[model samples]
Target: LHHLKTKRTEVYQDSSPFMSYSGCCCVLLPYSKCCYVLLPYSYRCYVLLTYSYLCYVLLSYSYRCYVLLSYSHFCYVLLSYSDCCY
Candidate 1:
C-alpha cells in the first residue's frame, strides 16, 4: 500500500489513499487475466502494464506528430509501427 501510494503520488501527482489503491488496481488488474499464464500474476501484470502504458504514450505522441506533420506519411508509418510492433 505504501509503495503504491508513493508510486501514485509520483506518477499521478495525487497522494490520496483512495487514489493509490484504485490506481494500483487500475494500473495492474486488467492485465491479470490475459497475462496470468505468462508469469507470476503480479509480476506479469506489472510488466504488461508498463509495456502497454509506455507503448500507448509513444503511440499517442506519434499520432500527434502524424496530425501535425500530415504532409508526410512517415509519422503515420511510425505510429503504425509502434502500435503493431511494440
Candidate 2:
C-alpha cells in the first residue's frame, strides 16, 4: 500500500506541471481492470483546432474576394467596350 501510494504521488508530481502548462485537467481513473489518465480539454488542443478553422475561414474569404474582383473587372471591361463602340 505504501509503495502504491508513493507511485501515485510520483505520477501526479510528474504530470501536474506538464498538464498545467497546457491548461489541461488531469484525472486518474481506476477501474477494476485498469487505470487510465484522462486529460480534459487542453488549451493546446483548442488552439490547434481553432487554428485550422481560422485558416479555412481566411482562405474562403480570400477566394471570395478574388472572385468578386474578377467579376467587377469583367464588368468594367464590358462597359468600356460598349462606350467605345457607341
Candidate 3:
C-alpha cells in the first residue's frame, strides 16, 4: 500500500506542470479518468495545448535524455517548436 501511494504521488508530480500550464481546475477520478474544468477562456489555453502537443511529439519520437542538462535542451527544442508553430 505504501508503494502504491508513493507511485501515485510521483504520477501527480509528473503531471503537475501540465495542470499548472492549463490553468484549469482538474480532478483525478477512478479508473484513470481526469476531468478538467476550464476557467475563463484565454490565450494561456492555446499555449498549454501547444506545449502538451510538443511533449507528445517528443515522447513519441523516443527522445532520450540521460542527464539533467539534456532535459533542459529538450525544453529548448519544445520552446522553439512552439514559437514556430504558434
Candidate 4:
C-alpha cells in the first residue's frame, strides 16, 4: 500500500494483472458498494477495474467522447458517464 503524508491508503491500479485496459476510466465509484475507485491515469489509457480478485470490467477508449463502462457480476454499476472524479 502507498502511504500518504500521514493517512494510509490502499494501493490499487486500473490495469489487471491478467487482462488489459484501453480507456480513461475516470472512476467515480460503485453505487452502494464498499469498493475503491481511482482516477484515470491518462486521457487515453487502459484501466482494468476489479474487486475481490474478480475482474469486473475492462476499460477501453471507444471514441473521442464515448463513456464506456461495464456492470459488475453482481449487477453493480461501478462507473458512470462522468468518471471525471478528482
Candidate 5:
C-alpha cells in the first residue's frame, strides 16, 4: 500500500504540470481507466488555451501594425529632410 501510494504521488507530480499547461491529460493517461479528476480541468484549460492563443495572434497583428506605421513615419521624415534633385 505504501509503495502504491508513492507511485501514485509520483504519477500525479509528473502529470500535473503538463496537464495544467496544455489540457492534455488524456494524452498522458490514455490507457488509464478514466480521468475523473483531470477531465474537467482539461476542458477548462483547453478553453483558456484557445482564448490565450487568440490574444497572442491579436498581439502579433498589433505589433505588425506598429512596425508598419513606424516605417512609414520614418520614410516621411526622410522625405521631408531630403531635397533630392530627381
Candidate 6:
C-alpha cells in the first residue's frame, strides 16, 4: 500500500542468500511468494541497495568534519580573544 513504505529493507530468506533492497523499487520473491518493495519518497529509508552486501563506513570520510570543527573553533577563539583584548 502507498501508506506503507520503507528504505533499505532487509528481506530475509531461510534458504536463499541475503539481499539489501533500496531506492524506491520492487521485486518478487518467487520462492517466498511475496513482493519486496521500497518507496522512494520515504523519509526513514535512505540509500537503498538491491544486492547481497553490507554497509561499510570509511574512517577517513569524516576528515572534512574535523577540519570544519577546527576552523569553527579557531574563528571563535580569534573573535573572543580580539573582543577581550579590545
- Where's the lowest-lDDT run of ten residues in candidate 5? 77-86
lDDT of prediction 1: 0.22
Root mean square deviation (Cα) for candidate 5:
22.1
Task: Give one digit per residue, the lDDT tens place, for model 5 in 1-86.
Answer: 01111112222224333333232221112233221122332342111122221221111121121111122223211111111111
lDDT by residue (1-86, candidate 6, tens digit) is 11223343564433333344444323333233232212224512112223223221111122111111122223211111110111
How many clashes show up per model?
0, 0, 0, 5, 0, 1
- What is the RMSD of candidate 2? 25.1
TM-score of model 1 vs. true structure: 0.12
Candidate 6 TM-score, true structure as reference: 0.21
TM-score for all models, in order of appearance: 0.12, 0.14, 0.17, 0.21, 0.15, 0.21
Per-residue lDDT for 47-67 in model 3, tens only?
Answer: 122332322222212222111
- Which structure is stronger by TM-score: 2 or 4? 4
Give each model's whole-structure lDDT: 0.22, 0.19, 0.24, 0.34, 0.20, 0.26
Please give the range of 10 consecutive residues that has the lowest summed lDDT in model 6.
77-86
Better of 3 and 5 by lDDT: 3
- Which pairs of residues collide in model 1? none
Q: Which candidate would rank higher by TM-score, 1 or 2? A: 2
Off by over 4 Å in 1: 1-47, 52-57, 61-77, 81-86
Q: Candidate order by lDDT, highest to lowest?
A: 4, 6, 3, 1, 5, 2
| lDDT digits (tens) for residues 1-86 of candidate 1 | 11121123233324422222212222223223211111123321122223222222222232221111122333222222211111
Residue 82 alpha-carbon offset, candidate 2, angstroms: 72
**Candidate 4 residue lDDT tens string, 10-76:** 3345435522223433332344222333335543333343455553442324311233233353433
Clashing pairs in 2: none
